[model samples]
Target chain A: MTAHTSSSSSLGLISSATAISQGAEAKVYYASLHPAPSPASTTETVDVLIKHRFHKGYRHPSLDNSLTKSRVAGEARALIRCLRCGVHVPGIRMVDAAEGVLALEWIDGKSVRFLLGGGAEGEEEEAADSEDSDVAEAAAQEDDTDPLSEYGATQDELMAMVGAEIAKMHRGDVVHGDLTTSNMMLRHPRSEKGLQLVLIDFGLAYTSTLVEDKAVDLYVLERAFASTHPASEPLFASVLRAYQAGMGREWTAISKRLDDVRLRGRKRSMVG
Target chain B: METYHYPSFPADASHVHIALFKNVSNAAELRSRIVRASLLEGSEGDLEREAVNFAFIDARLICSRVHLQTAIYQAVLAHAQGALRTKTVHSEILWTLNPSNNISEAIRRYGVSDTTAFLIVVRISTANDANVLANMQAVVSGELSRFSLEGITDWASVKKYYKLNSEPALKIQGITLVQERKIIDEIVTSTVAMKSVMT
Candidate 1:
C-alpha cells in the first residue's frame, strides 16, 4: 500500500481521540501529545485544537475542494495576522488544507456566553439558584468557587473584550465576517492577565478596510448579544464604549454606520 | 548509534539489518544509487533495498536526537502498515515533517530542499531484538565522514522550493540570523509533531 493508504487509515486514530466541538463550517476536536518523556515530564501532554473540514455533500467536488482549501488557508492567515497585531488568538499548530483540517492551541476555558446567562449550561441556572447569588459572590471573591467558575465571565467584560478585539482586528484591516458570543470564549484566569476573550470560527473572515464592513461586523455581535443573552443592553453599551476608546477618530464613522446598519439591518441598500 | 524499540509491535514482525556506506556524496547521488542498487540481481536487490530501507533525512532539519527519534518512530509505524499518505517513501519523509496529509506538496516543499547536506537514512523492517542494537551501532559508526555545515547547503534552491522569501516568520523585525535559524528549526519540528492533528 502507498503512503496515502496509511494516512487515510490513520485518520481513525487522529479523529477518535479528539473531543469534538461543533460549528457551522467544521467540527473541532481537541488534540493532544501524550506520554512523551520530557525534561518537565509533568507537562508531557500538550493540548491542541483540531478543525476538520468535513465533506459537504451539497457542493460540487471541485468547488468544495477550492472552498475548503481557501477557508483553511484564510483562517491560518488571519490567525497569523492577529498574532502579529498582538491579538490574543490561539497559535496555529498545524494546517492540512488538502484534508481541510487545522490544529491550534487548545485553550482551557468556556464560552463567554455561558457565563453571561446565555444558553451554555441550562442546568447551571438551577444549580446557581440552589447555591444562592450571595454565597456564589462570596465564593467568587474568595476564589474558591468551582474550578471552571473563572471561565464564567460577566456580560459586560465579555462585551468589552468583543469591542477591543474587533477594534484591533479592524485596525489591522481584517474583517471578522462572523461575530457572536457563542463564537467567543473566556480562558481560565490563572495569572494576573485576568480574563482573556478568544475569538473563534473565522470561516467567513477576510481582509477589508471598509468602514461599512466593520460596522456590520459589530452589528452582528450586537444582534447576537440581544438574542442569546438576557438584559444585555447595558452590557453592549459598555462594549461600544471600550470600542470607542480603541477605535480613536475612526469611531465616529463606524458608530454612525453602525447606527444606520441597526435601523436598515445588515444589508445596505445596494440600489444606487 | 542509537536504537529504539516500540513494545506494541508484534514479536515475529521484528528483524534487524544494517549497511554502512563510505563517503556517500550528495542527496541526488545517494537517491539514484539506492534506486540502482535496489534494481540489482534478486538477492543483491533484496540486500541493497534492505540496507537503504530507512528514510535518509537531512540531518540539518533535525533538532536533537530525541526529536529525530520521534519522527523516525512515527515513520516506521506508517511504513510497516503501508499507511503513508504520500506517493513515495522519499516524499513520506516530508509528509512526516508536515502536520497534514498533503504528501506531494510536502515533498515538493521540504524533501530534498536546496540547503540539505548531511543525510541520515532510516529503514524499518522485521528485526531480531538481539541483533538490532548491534546493527544500528555498526551503521552509525561506519566509514561515513562527520559532515560539516559550512561547506554544504544550497540556500537559493531551498528558498525557491519552500517559498520562504515572503513568509511572515522570516519578515519579523529585529531577529538575527541565528534567531531566524532557530525559529525555522522550531517551525519544522512543530510541523513534524503536529501530523496527528492534521488531516
Candidate 2:
C-alpha cells in the first residue's frame, strides 16, 4: 500500500487527493475540483471523488494505455447517459483519459451498505495496510446507534430510492453492471440537496436496452443484498415493488424475464 | 480578477490568472491583433505574441466557472502530454469547450468576436505572476470585474452550440428557468471534460 501511494503521488490530482478506498479496478479519493473561493464568503469548497485506474505492470504499456483510456471514456459516457436520464448519480467533474482518472461530484453521506450495518468497504483488505484509518472508523461507529435513523429515512424509503433509480437507469438503456448496496449512497439530510439516494461507481456500466440485461441488473443487486444483509428478502421485496411502479407498462416483460433469469441465474440459457 | 494556482500542474502552466472584463471596447481590434500576432515574424513576433497570449473567450456562452475550468484543465493536460491539437494551451481550451473537433470553428464561436461585450481573459503561467495582470490589461481594454456568470450567460447560444435543442433533459415542458440553466451547465461542463474521448 505504501508503494502504491508513493508511485501514485506523481499524478497531480491523485497526489493531492486523499485516498478513501482501494478496489481491484480503481483507487478512490476525495479532492476538490476547483480552487477554493475567497475566504471572505466562507463558502464551502466544491469537492470531487476521483477514481484512478492505475497502470498494470504485467500488461504491455501500449495495451495498458488503450485499455485504461477506453475504460475511463466508457465510465464517463455511462455517467453522462445516466445524468441525462435523470438518475440520481453524481455529476462528472473532469475526465483525464490519458491518465485514466475520472473525477465525480463528491457525495457527502454514507453508503447504504454501511448504513445497513454491513461494514464500510475494504475493511478486511485495508486492516493490514491502514491501521490508523481502521481505528478512526471504529471510533466513529458508536454502539447502539442505528446509522440509518440519522438520515431520517426508513429502510423502505431507501429501498424505494434504489429501485426507482435503477428503473430510471434501465429506462435510459444503461445497465449498471455492478449494483451493490456499497455502490449506493444517501446524501446527508442537512446537505444542500437534502436527503437523496445516489447511485455511483459506474466502472462496469454499459449501454444496453435488452430486458434480459436490465433483469440481470436487479438480480445482481438482489444477490448482493442476500450475501451482505441478513433478512434481506423483505427489503428487496420493497425494492422490487417500487421498481415495478417505476417500470410501469415495461414492468410486465421485465418481470417475466426476471423470473427466467432467477431460475437460470444471471446468464441466459444457451441453446443450439 | 481572480488568480488560481494549481499545484497539480507543472510550474510552466501551473498558475491560472483569469480576469473578467465587462464593457470590452476592443473586441474587433483584439481579434485582429491575435490574427496579426499569429502571422508575426522574428524577435518582434515573439514579443507581440507574448503580449496577447491570453485566451480571450466569449463570456456569453460560459454558464459557470466549472464550465470554463474543465476546458482549461483538459487543455493543460493535453499540453503536458505534448498532444495539444491547437497551437497553444490557450487556444486548446476553446477547442475543448467546443463540441466539434474543428479548431477554426471553435475559435470563431468561443473566441473573441466583434460584438463581444463581456470578455474572459485567461493566462496559464508560472508561480511568478509578476506583470501577468498588466500584460492582460495591455492586450485588452476593459473594466475588470469579479467573476460571476449571473445574467451574463446566453443560454440560447449555449444550447444551440452544444446541440441541446432537442435534448429530453431540457425539453421537458414547464421546467423552471433555474433548473434549465443548471442542467445546461452540468451537460456543458461534462461535455468539455470528456471532449477528447467524445466522438
Candidate 3:
C-alpha cells in the first residue's frame, strides 16, 4: 500500500480555487487536490470539488448532528455504489463526516445551470469574457449566440443525459433525494470527445428500493425544472423519454407513481 | 501482489501494495496473541514490534477498492483540509478503521492482531518512482522475510475478526478467493494513501 502523509501545515489551501456553491444544506467549494506521486505521472496539478455540509442554525443540536453525519455518509456510500454499478458519478476522493464535507473529482466544464443562464453572476461574467476573447480571436467566427450555446447540446439533449444517468442510478437502488439541472453539469469534455451530462450533489441520496422513493426522486427534479426554467415542460418530457428507455419495464410503475406524487406534492398527504 | 493508486495527491501516491487472505479462522487467537505480545518482556517485545507492523482489517465491512479508497481518501482530505482528529496520517488509518474517536483503542484493535492474514503494509514517500519501486521490492523480498506472494498470510484470523462468515461483498459477488484477496489488498492499500493527510 502506498501511503501519503502531507502535513496540513504544508498544504497551503489555495483560496483562489475556493469558489463556493451554496446548496440547501451545504456549501461546495471548487478546490485543488494534491495528487499522490506515481511512476508514470509527470505533473501534480488536480482540481476537486469539496462539498461542505455547513452547520444548520434552525435544527436541534443532536438531530442536526446525526442528520449532517448520515447525509455525508449516505452521499459517500451512494457514490461508491454508483461507481460499482458503472454509472459515471464522480469518484469519491475524500470524506469528512464529522466536518460534514466530501471532496470529489471536479468536472472541468460548466454546469447545466450555467450553460442555460442560471449560473452565478460572477461566472456569467467570466463566461462572457471568454466569449469576447473567442470572438476577438476570429471576427469570421463571431457567432451571435454565446460560446457556451455553441457547445451544441440542445436543452433536450442535456435533459436526456440527466434522465438516463438517474435511471441507471435508480436501477442500482440508489435514490437521489434531490435532483436539479443546477446539480447536473454538462462537462464539454476536456477534449472534443468527452462524456457530458454528469449528475452530482448526492448529499441527500439514500439507498432504497421503495417505488415511492424513486418516484419522489423524479418528481423533485420535475418540480425543480418547472420552477427554475419556465416553459421547460417539453425539455423535461424529453428527459423522461430517455429515462423511460433506460428504465425499461421499471418505468411503467415509476411513471404512474410520479403522477401520484405530483398530485400530492413532495410531502405525501398523511391525511388520507 | 495487488497494486493500488490514488491520483489525487502528489506523485508518490501512485505506488501501492495489497494482499488479501480469506477465511481467517483464528481471530480470537490472533487477538489474544497480539494482546499477549504487546505485554511481552525483553526480546519478545522487539520480535512482536517487528512482526506486527501491518493492519488487520475485517474483510466483511470492505466493499471494494473504491469503497476503501473513499474512506482513506476522506481521511487524507480531512487532514489536508486541516481536520485530522489524530496527529499523523499513519494513525489516521487506525482512526478510520474504528467507528468512534478513541485514538488508542483504534490503534490497538485495528492496527495489528495475531491472526491477521489480510495484511497490507505500505511505505509512502515523495521520492522518485524508481526509488519507491526499489524500496517496495526490498521491503517485500528482503527485510520482510515472512512475506511471500504465495505464503505469508494468516486468513483464519481475518475472517473471524471481520465476521466474514456472511457478507455480500465476499459471498454473493462473483469472485474467487484469490480475487477476493486482491480486492482486500486494494482496499487496504487505498486506506494507507488516504491516511497521508492525517494529523
Candidate 4:
C-alpha cells in the first residue's frame, strides 16, 4: 500500500475523479478533462476514463516500474491499432507512461453483460444499481420492455454487432485476449449512432494474425456466453453467422479452425 | 485563435495559443529564418530564437483540430517528463505528427515549406501573453483567421504522408466522404498520441 501511495503524485490530475472500478491490475476512474462549466454554459467538454496502474508492494520496484511502463505502452498501442482499423474502441486522450496512466474517451453506456440480463444476478451489479440511477433505469427499462430493444437492437442484432466488430478487429490482425460480454458496450441514446457497440479494455490485447489465435479469441467469448446466459447456444450461433459474413473469404479457414478448437479446447496438444 | 489552458500541466507550461495563418507570401523566408536561428551563437542567437519560438506547422497536412491537439498534448507530456526526443517541445510536436522517427524527415514534411499556403502557429507558454498573437502576426506576412479546421485540410497529402492508401480501413467500400474523413482524423490523432509507444 505504501508503494502505491508514494506514486499517487503521478495521478494528481485524477484525484478529483470518481472511482469507477478496481481490477487486479489498474484502478479505473471517470473524470472530466476541463473544469465543469456553469449549468447555462454551452462549452462542450467530454468526460474521460483514466486507467491508473499502481505499483505492487510485493514486486521489486525496478521490475514493477518496467512492467507497468510496458503494459501501459502495449495497451495504448493496441487501442491505436484498433482506431486506425476503424474498430469502434475508445479513442486515447492522454498517456503518461512513466506514471502508468492511460486516459481514454469516456464511453457513456451499459455493458453488454448488463443488457443481456446476466448482470442483475451479481452482488456487484446490485450495489452499482443502487448507486447509479442511470444504471438502474437501464436495468428497469429493460425488464419493462423488450430487454434488448432499448438499445434499438434485438438480441440477435446486438450479437451480430459483437461479431462484426470482432471480425473487423481480427482483420486488422489485433487479437483481443479477453473477450467477455462485460468488455463490450452500447453507446448511450444521446450519442450519435446510439446503438453502435464499442469494444473496451485492451489491457490484454495483442497483434496476432494467426488463424489459431483468432479462433481461440472467439472461443473465449463463446464459453463466456454459455456460462453467463440461459439458452446461449443459439445466441453464440448467431454471433458466428455475422462474423462469417464480415470476414468474407477469410471466414472458411477461421471457422474450420474454430471447430477444431472446440473439440480439443483452446490449447494445442503439447504431447505432439 | 483559441487559447487552451491544460489544468494538469505544470503552471509554467500550461497555456497554449493557436492561430491559423492563410495566404502567406513569406513561407520561404520564414523557413530560412527558422533554419538560421538554429545556428546562431550567444546573445545575438537568443534574440533570433525568441522571435520565432512558436511551432510553424503546415496546416494543409492537419486533418482536424483534434489531430493537432493530440500532437501538442503528447509533445507537452514528453517535455514535462524530460523525455523529449527533440530539443524543444514545439519541434517535438512536429516529430509526433509524422509517422516515421527521422527528425529531419518530420520537419521537412510537417514544417512550413516554401510552397506552404496556410500555416498553423502554436505557442506553448507560461503566461497567456497578450503580445504572443501580435508577435506571430508580425513574423508571418499573412491573413490571420479563426482556428477552424474545416475546409482547410489537404486529404490527399495526408493520405500520402501517412500511407493510408494501402490501409484496409480506408479501402472499405461504401464509406462516405464524411465518414472517411472522420476515420482518418481519429487514426491520425491516435497515432500522434501513441507515437512514443509505437514500435
Measured by lDDT, the strongest candidate is 2
Candidate 3 CAPRI-style tier: incorrect
Give chain B TM-scores in order: 0.58, 0.98, 0.45, 0.97
Which of 2 and 4 is ahead in DockQ? Answer: 2
- lDDT rank order: 2, 4, 1, 3
* CA-only RMSD, every prediction: 7.9, 3.4, 9.2, 3.4
Please identify which of the two predictions, 1 or 3, would achieve the higher DockQ against the true structure.
3
What is residue B103's positional error in candidate 3, in angstroms? Answer: 17
Residue A12 displacement in candidate 4 (angstroms) = 3.0
Q: Per-residue CA lDDT of candidate 4, range A191-224, in tens? A: 7434578999999999998999999999999999
Every model's DockQ, to 2 decimals?
0.10, 0.44, 0.13, 0.39
lDDT of 2 by residue, A1-272 (tens): 22333333237677777998777778889888777543223254668888998888788888888999899999889888877777778878777777788888888899999888887876656666898977876776756578888998998999998888888888889999999999999999897556879999888999998998999999999999999999999999999999999889999999998888889998766886
**Candidate 4's error at A7, in angstroms?**
10
Candidate 3 lDDT over residue span A15-95, tens digit each: 334756564777768875554333333233445787777668788867887887777777777766665454556655555
Residues A28-89 of candidate 1: C-alpha lDDT, one tens digit per residue: 77756332331222333445677888768788877887888778878877766665454556
The candidate with the higher lDDT, 1 or 2, is 2
Every prediction's TM-score for the first chain?
A: 0.81, 0.89, 0.77, 0.88
Taken over the whole model, the C-alpha lDDT of each candidate is 0.60, 0.85, 0.59, 0.84
lDDT (10s digit) by residue, model 2, range B1-199: 7777677776798788778899999999999999999999999999999889899899998998888888988888888777799999999999998999999999999999999999999999898779977888887889888888788999999999988887756765687898788888888888788787785
Candidate 2 structure lDDT: 0.85
The parts of candidate 1 lying over 4 Å away from their true place are A1-7, A18-25, A31-43, A57-70, A94-100, A121-159, A190-195, A244-252, B1-137, B141-199
The numbered model that scores best in TM-score is: 2
Residue pairs clashing, model 4: none
Tell me the TM-score of each prediction against the true structure: 0.60, 0.91, 0.59, 0.90
Judge candidate 1 at residue A233 and give its lDDT.
90
